[model samples]
Target: MGTWIKETDKAIYLMDGAYYLQKIDKTAHTGQVEGETFFRTGQLKTWLNSKEPPGFFLVSVGTGVSEPQPLPPPPAPPLSQGITITKSPSQVKIYQPYQVAGTASTSLVGKTVELYIDNSSSPAAKTTINDNQQWLVQSVFIAVPKPQVRNLKVVAGDASDVATLTLTPYIEDHPGGTKLNLGGSVGSGGSNRASDVRKVQERLIALGYTFANKNYETFVQTIRLFQSIISGRTAVRGVDGRIDVNGRTQRFLEAANAPQWMLMPSRGVGFYNLEVIDQPWDKHDYGIDWMSNVIKAAGIHYELAYRKNREGIAPIAVNDVSLPQGGDTIDHAGHETGNAGDLALPRLDGDFGGITWSDRRYDRPATKAVLEALRAQPWVNKSTLYFNDPVLINQRLCSRAAGHDNHIHFEVMVPPTP
Candidate 1:
C-alpha cells in the first residue's frame, strides 16, 4: 500500500515502483514536499518518495519531459603585433653590401619586410620573415656617390624603425694621387723631369685649382695660391716656390684631400690654428663627424640671432678639437678624444686673434647667446662648459675654472660604437 491524496482537480498517489498523479485537482495544486514540487495536471511533478534524502520522482503529469539547456563559454583575448630591430650598422662604405637584422611578430612571419633609404617610398631592399619570427636582409647595397650621412629605415606591416649610416669614400692610392718627389723645382726643366711637373699640375687641378702651364714660374704662383686658400688668410706661410712633396706642402695636400677630414667654418666659427699647428707632427687639425655636427649646429644658432636682427656676427674662435685619428695632443688633458673643443669668447672688435681676460672687449651678449645655443644641442653635455666669467658662472650656465677665463671648453658625449 502507498499513500494517496485526492482533490477536486487531480489525484496524487504513491505506487509500488513509482509515484503517480491523475488529473483530479482542477484548482491548480502546486506545493513543495521535501524540496520537490507537485504542480497542476499539465505541468511537471517532482517528489521525495524514497528513503534516500536526495532521491525524487520527476515526471510530467500530462506533458512530456524537456531537456536541460547548457551555458555559453567565455570569449578569447586580443593578439599583439609589432616589429623590432635588434642589429644594424652604424657605418657603411659607398657601393658596399652589409647586413641588417631584426625580429617581427608571428602575424608577420612569412611576410615581406622592406628597407628604405631616407624615407623613400620605394624600398631599397627586402627580405622575408622566417618561422621563428626573425628576419635578416643580407648584402644590402648603398649607392651613394660620396661620403656623407644617410638614414636607413626598416618596415614591416605597420611598424618601422630608423638608423643612421656614415658612408666613407674608398680611394686606391694616396688621397692626393701617386706619391711624388715633390722636392726641387721641376717645372720647365728647372731641375727635375717633366713628368714631375705634370704630376703637380694634375694634383693641383684635382684640388679645384686652375693651372695650365707646366713652367716653374706658373707652378710657383699656383702653389702660392693653394697655400693662401688653405691658410684662409692672405699671408701664406712656408710658400717659397719649392715643391717639397714630402714636407709641409705634402702634408697640407694630404690633409686637403683626406676623405675623413672636414674643415671647420672659417667665418662663422673660427679655429685657433696656432694650437693645432703646434701639436706633434703625427697630429693634424680635424674632428670626427660627431663633434663637427654639434659645432656646426651651435654656430648656426648663434649666427641666426644676429642674422635675424640684420647685424653682422663675427666668427667664434674654436680651439683644439682633435687630431685626424683622435689621440692625445699636446697641452690638452681631454681633447685626446675627438669630442672636446675650446671656443674663445667673442670680442667687440670681431677679431679672435688677441682675446684675453683683461681685454675689456668681451662681448657678453654674444657669449651668452652662444652658451644658450650649445645647451640646446642634443649631443653637447650641458654641464661640461667650463669658464671663469663671473656673470656666466653666477647664471649657472658655466662652471668657474682657472684657465678658462679666455675661452670656454666644451665636450660632446659620443655614443658607444656597436
Candidate 2:
C-alpha cells in the first residue's frame, strides 16, 4: 500500500490500525519516524497538528477512511456571588447553646463554612454546606466574658457576611435592694427621659454592661437580660425589659452593685489560714472576692515560681484580712474592709510563724519573691507595702512603717468595670 498525507476541508487526518506503530511526525517524510505510537484516540489530535512538522501524512489501512475528531472544550467555572447570613438572633445568652443559619453559593456546597467573631482569624464554629446550598451550625456557644456587642461573620470561599449580636452573661441576678432611684421608667417602652435613661445606663456601665452610646436597642436588650436573670419573688414583677420606679429590677440592680464581702475559706487551695492572734472577736478573714482571689493567686505563683520544687516551701500564711462585719480593729489602724491584709514573711526554715525582717531567720530572697509574685497579680491595686525592710524598700518593694516591723501589710482596690 502507498502511504501519504491526507487533508480535508475542516481538518487534517492520519489512520492506521496497528496500535504499536510509532508516531510519524511531519519532519520525517522520506524515512520511517521512530517514536511512540499515537494509537490511542486521546492523543490523536495533538499528534495530527500541522505547526511543527516536515509536512507528511499517513494513508488509510483499508477501504473505509477514518477521521479524528477534537474533544469538546471544558465547561466554564461557576461564579461566586458570596454567602449570606439569613437567620441569627439579635440577642444571645453567653456560653449557651445557640444556632446560626445561612445560605452559600452552589459552588461552595460541601465546602467549609466558618463562623468568626469580630476580626478573629480563628473560627468560633464551622460546618459544611448541604446539597441545597445551606449551612447550619447547631448548639455552638458564643463567648461573652463581659457584657458587649459582637459581630458574627460567616465565610465561604471568598464571600462573607456579618451579623451584629449582643451577648449577656448567663449568671442569675440574685435579689438585692439598691438605693439608686429613677425619676421615671428607663428601659424599653419606658419614659426614656434623657436623665433617667442616662442614670440607668451609667449604672449598668458601672455594673459591666457596655455600649458605645445611649441607644434604645442596646438598652432594651441589656434590661431584658437583667430581668430574665433576676431570681426570687419581689411581688408581681415581670421580665418586660423596663425599669419602672421602685421596680424589682431597680432593686435587684442596686443590690447586685452593693459593696459585698466574701470570707476566705479556712485552709483553701493556694493559701492557708492563721486565725486572729489575740483579739479573736475583732480580727477576721472577711474580704471581697476579687482581693481574696489576688491573694490566692499570689500564693500559688509564689510556691510554683519561687522554688523549682514546691515540695519544701510552706504555703504563705495569712494573719488578717478584715472583720467578719468589716469594721475598725484595735490592732490595725486600717483593716476595716477586705482591702488590706497581713502576710507573715517567709522564714529561712520554711516556717509559718511570724518573723521580723531583722531576725536572722528571715528569708529575704524568698520573701522578696513572694512579694514580687503578689504584686504581679493583675487585680492587685499596687498599694504601698508597710514592711520595714531597708533593702526591699530600696528595691521599691516596700516602705518603712512605724508599727509594721513584724509582718508585711498590703492593700488592694476593687477592679474597675469595662
Candidate 3:
C-alpha cells in the first residue's frame, strides 16, 4: 500500500506502501529518517527510483521489515515511422488535377517522395518532405484517355503506400453544359497534336467510328464524317473538319466518350422492321445488354405467332430505353439505370401505331403474347414487367400501373456490367 512522493530535484520515495519525502538537512531529522534497518537475513533493501538526474533512495523503518518495491519504468513512446497516405478521393475525372498528400517519418524528413502511376519506374510526380515530416504533391494531373482504374504508389525513403482511383471522362462544366475541350489542335491541314488527336480518336472509336491513323489527314476525315452524322446531313461540304478545345465538336465528343450500354441491333428473323425513333431530345437509345436481349427475344416471339397462323401482326413500335450513359430522361422515371424499356402497344388491325395505353384498339392478344415472351426470358420474372392492362394484371403476367394503359414498360432484374 505504499505510495510515491515527489521531492525537489526529481526525487521520489516509497514508505509503508505510501510515499514520504526526506529533508536532507542533517540538522533536522524531523521528516522520515533516512537510516536503513537490516532484516535478520542481512540482505540490502531496495526501492523504486526514476532514472533522471537525481536518483531515489530507500529508508527502512526497523529490523526484520522489508522495503517497498518501486514499480517498473513506463515503456518509451513508440517511434513514428511508416508513410501513410490520406484525404484523397478513391475516384476522379480523367483530366482532373488532384493532390496526393501523406506523412513521412521524422527520419525521412527532407527526403524526396515520389509518386508512381501504374507501377511505372519513372515517377510521375514528386515532392520533398518538410521539417514536420509531411509531404504533398499538389496539382498532379493524370491524362487518362478513357474510363479505367489506376493505381498510385507513393514512396519516401523506406516507407511506401498505394491507392486506387477510378478515372471517368473529363466532362467540363458548361453552366448547364456537358462537354470537355479537345485541348490541342485536331483536324486536317492543321498542326495536329498527337495526344489531342488520340483523345478524339478514342472517343470516336467508343461511339462506333473508325479512325485508322493519328495524323492530321485521318483526323480531318473523321471529324468531317462525325459532323455529318450528328447533323444528319448527307453532304459534308459545309461541315468544318476542325475542332478546337471548346466547341460543339468538343461537346459532342464529351457525350460520345460517356459510358455506353449496348443497344440491340435492329435486326432479327421476323422482327427486323422495328423502327428506333431518332429524335434530337431522344436520340440515345441504349440499355444494358441483357435488356437488349430481352427486347430481341420478345420481338421474335411476336413475329413468330403471326407467321404460325398467317395472321397479320403489326410491327411493335419501341420507345426510349435509356440515354447513352443510362441516366435520367425527360418525362420518365426508373430508366436512369438503363434496365427499363417502353414499347408502344400494337394495333388490333395489324398496323404500326403510336403509344396508346387505354385505346380500345390496343391489340390485347398480341400484347399478351409479347408479355409471355418477355416473361419467358431467363432474366425476367413476375415483378419485372410493368403494364396497366387489366387482363394481364389479373393473370399475373404483369403488374398494373396508372400510366401504362397504352404501352408496356419492361425492366430487367439486374443491371449488366458496363
Candidate 4:
C-alpha cells in the first residue's frame, strides 16, 4: 500500500482509504495502483517494469473529484465581472415577461450553480436553463414592472470552476440618442474631476464595490460615467467617437449620483447651504454621485476652501456654501481641500430628524439632508455639517452629534497609529 505521484496534475495520491493522504514517491518495486488498471496484484505484476502502462492507481487515480465541473449549455460564456447601479431603479413597473439570459463554459458535468440578483429588495428573479447551458429568468420573476432597471449576477460553484457573471439593466439610450465613445479629454465640461472622482468612489463602496489602494484603478473604477465614456462601454462616445457629454441624459443620470456640498459660513464657523452641483463635475467637474449615493434634494456644494487652517480648521473664501459679504468672486483657486462626510444613515436615503429649508421646522432641514446623505457611504470617513446650529440646520433633524451649528466640518480621518 505505497503511493505514487503524477508529474503533470498537481493532485495528491492516497495510500489507504484515508482521504487526505499526500503523494509518496515512486518505489522500485511494483504492484497495483488504483488508477492504471483494475487487475489484482498478480495481473499488475506482469505489466510492471515491461514497457506496459503503469497500474491505474500508480498511473493516476481519478477520484472523480478533479474532473472540472460540467458547464451549463453555452449561450454566452459566463463573465466573472462586477456590477453597480449608478441609478437604481426604485420604481418597478409592469413590463411583459421578457427573457433574461447568460452563458458560461465549465469542465464539470452535473454540477449546479446559484444565480443571484443584486441588492434586490424584491425576491430572486426566476431562473431556469434552456438546452445548452443557456440560462433565463422565468415569468414569475419578470412580474416586476418596468421603466426601472434590474441588476443580474451569477456565481458558479461547488467552488468556482468557472468565472462569475455580473449583469445590470440600465436605461438603454432612453428617449434621447445613441453613441459610444471611450476617451478622456482635458477641461471637458461637467463636474468630472478630483472631487467627483472621490464621490464616485464613495458611492461604489456603499454599493459594495472593492478596490485597491492604488489611485489609477480606483479612479477608473469609481466613475462609471468616465468608464463608459473612456472605456468604450457606454453611450458617452458620440457618433464620431467624440469624447463628450456636455449635457446628455446618461450624463444627467451620472450627475444625479454625485454628492451635494455645504459651506462653513463666511461670517462664522457655522455651516450653510449655498449652491448645489447636482453631481461632482467631471474630472474637471463637480458631482457627488460621482462619489456615492449621498444626496440632497439638490446635491453637493462646500466652502470654496480657504488657505490658512481654522482653529480646528484652515484658511478662507466662498466655502462651496456661499460667498461671504458678496463680492464679485469668480476665480476657482486650485486648492482642492477635502473634508470627511458623515451621516448615520443607510444605503437608502435617510429621513434624518434635521429639518430641511423647505421643512421650516426647528431642524435645519437643508443641512440635515445633505449631512445625512453623506453618512451613508463608505468613502466619507468623517465630515462636519451645519446642523448643530439653530439656523443652518434645525436641531429637530439631528438625533445625534448634538447639532452642527457653526458649520459641519468633514475631515478624512484615517485609522489609528500603532
Candidate 5:
C-alpha cells in the first residue's frame, strides 16, 4: 500500500501492514514526539476508542482502508523481541550499589535505556544497549529509612518494562575470612590503625552518630556513647570505648542498620498475640507502620498468661499504630512516628470491651502483668508507659497520664539520628 497513515490528535504512521502511534514524552524529548508500536491490534483500537481528543477525527491516507477495522487474532504467540528484564535484586539495601540487567531487541542495539525509580521525574540510571542487545545499569542505589517496596521502570525508546524490588535499610555485613579482622583496635588506649579507625568512623556515621572531628578523644567519646546507646553497655566498666577485631562492639555496629518490619497480625499463636484492633474514634485503622519489635514484645508479654494461669484471657488488642508514611493521624497528640501505638486496656472476664482504668471492670492485675512484660522488652523504653492506672502508678509499673485512662500508649526505642 502507498504511504498509508492515520491522523488524529496523535499521528499514527501505518506502513507494511503495521501501525505505529506517536505520543509526546516530555522527559524523552525537548520538542519532538516519540512513536510507540502496539503489538496487538486490539490494544491500538482500545487506545484509539478511549483517547480520542476533543474536536478530533481520524484522517486516513491513501485508499488502503477508510476506517480502522478489527483484524483476526494471530495464530502464533508473539515473538520474543521486546525489552525484558533478566536480572534484578529482589531485595536491595538503602545507599548500597546494585545493578539491573535486561535484554532488548537486536534492532534497539546502540540505543539508550532510561531507568526511572518510583515516581521520580529524573532517571535513576541510563545505559546504551550493546551489540548483543543486552543492557546493564550499574551502581544503582536507593536511600530510605525503613523497609519498603520500590517501583522501577525502564524505557528504551517506546518500549518500556516495569519491575519491583524491596528497598531495605542498609545493614552492613561482616566481612568473611581474613577480612573479618580489623587492622587494629579503633579507640583510646589501642593501636588505632588508620584504616581500622576510618572503617569504624564510617560505620558510626551510617548509624547516625556525628562527631566534631576524628580527634583521638572525640572518637573515644563517640565510641563510648555508641556503646552506651547501641551496644547496650551503659555501665562505666562495661564501656571500654574500643572496638577490637571481631569484637562485640564491631558486631553490633555491623548489624546496626538491619531491615525493619511492619507491624502485622500474628500467624500461628492464639489469644496471646497482640492482634490489630479497630479504633472506634478514628476513621481508618492505620496500623501500617514499622512496629515489629512492639508486636513481638506483645507476644512475649502475653505468653506469660500461660505461666500466670490466665490462659483464657482475651487477645491483646492494639490500635492506631501510625500511618504507612509515619505522620500524625486525626485526633491524636503523639502518634506522629512509627514506633508508638495504643494498647486496649484489659477488662473483666477477659473480653475486649471498653473499660477505663478507674472502672471496676478494669482487670488491674492482668493489665499490670502486660505492663511488666512490655517493660522487660529490650526495645521498649522502660519508664515511658502513658497509662493512668492509679494502682499501677503507685506500684511504679506505669506513670500517670491526663487522658490515658482508657488505653495505654507505649513507645518502642528507635535508632538515634544526628
Candidate 6:
C-alpha cells in the first residue's frame, strides 16, 4: 500500500497498480522517445462469495488506441497468481506477499539476472547462491512454468552500466487451490439523526417553515415549496440545523412530552420495525457516517447499531412527531423496542426539564457541542436542544427560535424514495 510511481523517462511497462520499472537502452539509438519495453506482474482472484477478483494489465508503448499496431494480445487474468522475483548480482526480491516470506530469496546475494523461471516457486533445483553477498549463483530454480499458471520466476537484468530492470511475476495456482481472501472496519457516529425533531424545525426556518417551528413531517410538504435551488426547484434545508429548545420555546418539551401521548399505531407508540440500505444493518454507505456524526454531536457514545452498515452509511427510520393526546401514560422501559432507540446518556449529556434517561447525568459542554456538531450534518431535519432551565434556552447565545424548553430535537432529511 505504500508504493508510489514516479514520473520518469521510463513508464509502467506492466500494471497491477504495483509493478514499477525504469527503462534501459543497450544502444544509444534505442533511447528514442518512441522506444518501448515489456515486463509482467502477477494476477489476483476473488475467493469470497461476496467479492470480485482483481486483474492486472500489460503496459507497452504504441498500444494507446491509435489503431496502430497492437503490441500483442493482453495476458489472461489467471496469470496474476504467482510470485515475482527481481534478481540483482547479489539479491533476489519477491513481489506481492508485500512482505518478507521465508529465508530463500533474502539469504542469496551474488549474480545479476533480471528474468526466467516459471509456474512453480519450488525452485526446480538448488545450487550455490551465496547470501554472504560476495558470490554469484549459477543454479536455476523452477521449470516449464506456464504463463497463466500461478508461480514464481527469476528475473535477472542485463548489466553494463544500466540501472533499470524488467519486473515480470509468474503466478501459479496451487494444486489444491490458491486460497486468497483477507481484510477488516470502524464506524463514524453522528451527533444527529435522520429523525431528529429539532433538525426538522431549524430546516423549517431555513425554508421559512414558521415562527412556531414545530411538527416537522406534518409541514414537510408545505416547506418543500420554499426550498428554492439554483435550478429553481423549491427546497427544504433538509434536517441540518437545530434551535435550542429549553429556552424561551417549550417546543422541545412539548414534542418530547407530547409525542408519547399521541395516538400510537396498532403495533403501539414505538413500532419501528423497518430496514433501509442506509440503516446500520444494511450495506455500508454515506448514511452511517451521518448517523455516527449525529450521535457524536449529541455528546453520546454508541456501540454501532448494525455491523454491516459499519462499512458505509446506514439509512434512518421513518417516523412522525406530534402533540400528545388526553389520557396518555408514559412508560420508561428498555425492551429493545424497535421504536425506542437508546443512547449513551453520559454521551448525550443527560436529560432536559428534570427528565433523566438511564440514570446518566447530563453535562452542558456535551449539550452545546452536540448542537454544534449536528449543525455540521446536511441531512438533519430538526433539533430539540433541552436545557436544565428556561432562561438558559432563551439566552442570546442560541438563535432566536420561538419555543424551546425541555430539549432540542434535531432531524436529518433523507431523499424521498421513488
Scored by TM-score, the top model is 2
1-418, model 6: which lDDT tens digit per residue?
Answer: 3222222234432122434322222223344565554333221111112143223334344445321121345677652222222332222212111111111233233434322234333432222223432211222112223342333334322222112222233323321111111111000122234344444444333322243244543333322222211112212233222223232112322221111111222121111212221234421111111232333322211111111123322112222221121111132211111111122112232222233322245444444433433333333443333223333345422333333333343433322211
TM-score of every model versus the real structure: 0.36, 0.43, 0.37, 0.21, 0.37, 0.19
Q: How accurate is candidate 2 locally (lDDT)?
A: 0.59
Question: Can you rank all candidates by lDDT, best first?
Answer: 2, 5, 3, 1, 4, 6
Cα RMSD to the true fold for all candidates: 20.1, 18.5, 21.2, 23.5, 20.9, 28.9
lDDT of 4 at 161: 41
Instruction: Write the residue-wise lDDT of candidate 3 on 34-103 in tens digits.
Output: 6422222111122334332224334442343433345545699765666777545555543233556667
Once fitted onto the true fold, the runs of candidate 5 whose alpha carbons sit more than 4 angstroms away are: 1-263, 266-290, 305-311, 415-418
The lDDT of each candidate is 0.54, 0.59, 0.55, 0.30, 0.56, 0.27
Q: Pick the candidate with the highest lDDT.
A: 2
Query: Each candidate: how many clashes?
Result: 6, 4, 9, 122, 0, 113
Cα error of candidate 2 at position 279, Å: 9.2
Put down candidate 4 lDDT per residue, 264-307, tens digits, no spaces.
Answer: 22222223222222213312122222221222211321111111
lDDT of 5 by residue, 1-418 (tens): 3223354333343322444333221122334456432233553454445544222334553446634333445698654556888877766654344556777777788888777777788887676776667776643343454335667777786555444444443544523112325778878787887788887776655443445145777678667654544432222234778888777667656653422223445432322324343434443233321245455534544443222344556555666554432333565665543456677787777764478988888887778767765664445666667898888888888897788989887766634321
Q: On TM-score, who's better, 3 or 6?
A: 3
Q: Could you tell which candidate, 4 or 5, scores higher by TM-score?
A: 5
Ranking by TM-score: 2, 5, 3, 1, 4, 6
| 14-119: candidate 2 lDDT, tens digit per residue | 4332221233333223446753233234445565453543245545444364444433446987646667777776655432335567777777888877777767
Question: Which of candidates 2 and 3 reaches a greater lDDT?
Answer: 2
lDDT of 1 by residue, 1-418 (tens): 4423322113343323333332323343255543333445432233343343223333344453332222234466543466677776666543234456677778888887777776578876666666677765533332334434556777776554333343333422334544655555543334556677777676665544444255556566656544433332222334455556465555555542322224333334322343454444634355544466566656654544232343444455677665543334566666643556788777776655356545688777777766866764555677778988888888988887677878888876533211
Better of 3 and 5 by lDDT: 5
Of the pair 1 and 2, which is ahead by TM-score? 2
